[model samples]
Target: MLDPKLMDEPARIAALDRYDVLDTPREPGFDRITNLVRSILGVPISAISLLDRDRQWFKSLNGLDASETPRDIAFCDYTIRQRAPMIVTDAHADARFCDNPYVIGDPNIRSYAGIPLETPDGYNIGSLCAIDIVPRQFDPGQIAILQNLAALVVEQLELRRIAERDHLTGALTRRAFLGEMNRAIALFERHQRPASLLLFDIDHFKQINDNHGHPAGDQVIRGIARLCTGLQRPSDSLGRLGGEEFGILLPETGQEDAARAAQRFCETIAATEIPGTPPLRVTVSFGVAELRSDWPTCESWLAVADMALYEAKRSGRNRVAIARHDASHAT
Candidate 1:
């Protein structure tokens, strides 16, 4: 029986969402493990199941089985709800199994054992289970090996999660951001659809550390990051390029749009009230530039924006400056 209280639907759904790995095609590494289990144990079926909202989705499976089954009839559902292995020696003999559709009808699972697949933090996401038409028993060694295999499944899932994330701001961290930027630039160059980059930096961030304290400065940096993130559009990318500097990649935006975004970033920082500190207002300067066809690469296009940023700092701090590549660099 499933524990109603412990099997939190919302938390489980949230965990599944974080993986960003639903409905993906099967990978060979996962398939190999399921095949090995079936071959070694001489079972009719073996699977690496992921418990989804209303179904048990098989990432990997061996033998005749469907890719998905209803959650109500899913053995993996009960498997994940428990911390330890769920073993049913004879489905017909057990009270819980006798009433199960899987036991009485199709598949007729007579012998079953499943080990929970858990994340590093101990959230049991699903299970690695083996099924046989005939009743059977597993030795201690087999159970241990199955548990170890489930751990490997989790390791693979974690690797995929880290690959898609940006290490700095906990946002989409792919070099692919530039790939999208390039496409946007191409459209702007062709149809004059308008695009811009708001390159900016923390004003006197170094002095903040020297005066207030490094910890306070770190808080300020984090505060700025939050502000920038809050000001972003779904289509916009806000990333920390390096220390004390950040880049906002905007699409379909002109000088006015870029200037507005820059102003919002600066104002957000100024209005924020830092804890345990006097009313200290922070400011940021901006360099806005439009995309150009002559700039064949992302680097060259960004160079124009960077130059505008340099001018903003040189003219005076806490100001926005626009750079047109057609014009000479801001002196």
Candidate 2:
């Protein structure tokens, strides 16, 4: 059992957020590890489970039909609270799990073995677990194998974190941003959840570079990224789409709210002086587009947003333009 006094919940969640793996589509890299775990351990179920705020989301699940379970009812929840591997030889005989729903009902988990997927910074973000339907004891050799596999899972997560972020602004790279947009699209398709995109770029950015030099432009970009990152919610994603251009994906947000956010961003950036040799003030134009049921792909959605951005630039910059649902133009 984990001691309540030993846990720093907020810091742990922040560490997990740095990975940016939540709500992402399953990848072959993770799926392969889960598959290997099931095969090597001879378990009916093996999963790479990440503990979100209220749920234990499966990054990869082998032999499981469900994608997630309530955190309170998850066996992996306990695994993440301690450094050592958590093993239950018989769930029915254990006081902690005898009344668990998964133990008594579906899956009938009789045995379990899990290793904590600890980040390099020492936060236990989740677990890699091997589950069995029949009571069994895992030998020392088997535990060692599971531990090694869990390390591989953490390594993959670290690699993804490095690959997805921009080197200068620490924002999501263009490719990773598009990937996140696709994931949001999938979520909206499945659950009809409202989401919106905001595309913006620094107004007269080339003039700033030419007048003040490229170093000044780089500082301005970093400043804008920091400002937007600070303003966004935990669920929102900020990305560096290209030179002087950035995109923000606001999950569960509508066009109206997103436009308001973009307006705020525009006003804030225009008012603040970015730190440099002489300091620089810059304005930005914004395009806001909500996810539409008719849009079939991420590219279509992005195109609409891009059109709206062009409208903002045409309408005198430092303003927000909302894309129409018809995909024709912005208002």
Task: Say which candidate scores most in TM-score.
Answer: 2
What C-alpha lDDT values do all the predictions have?
0.76, 0.92
Residue-wise lDDT of candidate 2 within 1-331, one digit each (tens)?
6655229888888898888788888899999999998999899899999998999999999997988899999998899889999999999999999999999999899999999998898898999999999999999999999999999999999999899999999999998998899889988989998899999999999999899899999999999999999888988999999999999999999988999999999998999998988698999999999999766478888899999999999999989999878874331
Pairs in clash, predicted candidate 2: none
Worst 10 residues of 2 by lDDT: 322-331
- TM-scores for candidates 1 onward, in order: 0.53, 0.84
RMSD to truth, every model: 9.3, 3.3
Which residue runs of candidate 1 sit more than 4 Å off their true CA positions?
1-7, 166-331
Candidate 2 Cα deviation (angstroms), residue 184: 3.9
